[model samples]
Target: MRSAPRSMSEEVIPLVEESAVVGKREVVTGRVRVRTVTDTIEELAQADVQHETVEVTRVPVGRVVETAPEIRTEGDVTIVPVLEEVLVVEKRLVLKQELHIRRRVEQEAVEVPITLRKQRAIVERTDPEDPAPEGPPT
Candidate 1:
């Protein structure tokens, strides 16, 4: 029974741990107010519109055509061919006057009267010691 062997700063023992450092700050929790309202409406609209009119007629063809007569569309009637170069017994290509064009389309029924405008947004929630609300939050 003999015990004696312990020396290196007495077998070292020195320790301590305890820490707390937490920080954050920003607080102003309540302020929002907005307002805008406008509305107007009146409407009456209808449409069916088409108009085209052209009528020209002059027909007198004294007959004699060997060449130069090509402008024809017959149904809506459009025939334009008028040419005359005649010296009797040598040069003849005469069929003077023919210009008949007719086109007519008319349909009319129209009425229009319109005025419209609309806008709406209104929200209110204010409390930051309540004394800052009179005008300017939109």
Candidate 2:
């Protein structure tokens, strides 16, 4: 029997395939951590504080005056006169009483306990690759 020749369109062709590979990995670059710490320190501070107190005393006074006396101060003692008008058929003025205002200043050495605070930064570095620790992160 005679064999027939194949047509151009019927001819078979072999082909090779090429492809790209995709992948992912995890890398430990570094780490950062924050922490808070507290510390105490001693310091000295000076300030002026005022304290007020009152003292009273009485004495006998038997006198009569025409007009009110003027306010005066001697040393740290202040003298103030209280007056009233003695009324008769005619209008009149008379010294009634006196009031004294006194002021005293005293200072005592005192030791005060106070609390102070301060902030400081401390950093440490570590690497998985290195067996020893690095001194600081920076």
The model with the greatest TM-score is 2
List model 1 lDDT by residue over 33-53, tens digit each. Answer: 878888888987789999999
The sequence of per-residue lDDT tens digits that candidate 2 reaches over residues 1-138 is 987986667666879989999998997676554445567888766666667765544433435676667988777777777766666897766665666667666665555778798766765555656554457333
Query: Candidate 1: TM-score?
Result: 0.38
Scored against the true structure, residue 41 in model 2 reaches a CA lDDT of 87
RMSD of each: 11.6, 9.4
The C-alpha TM-scores of every prediction are 0.38, 0.53
Q: How many residue pairs clash in model 2?
A: 0
| Candidate topping lDDT | 1
Please identify model 2 stretches exceeding 4 Å from their true place.
1-34, 42-50, 58-62, 128-138
Model 1 pairs in collision: none
RMSD of 1: 11.6
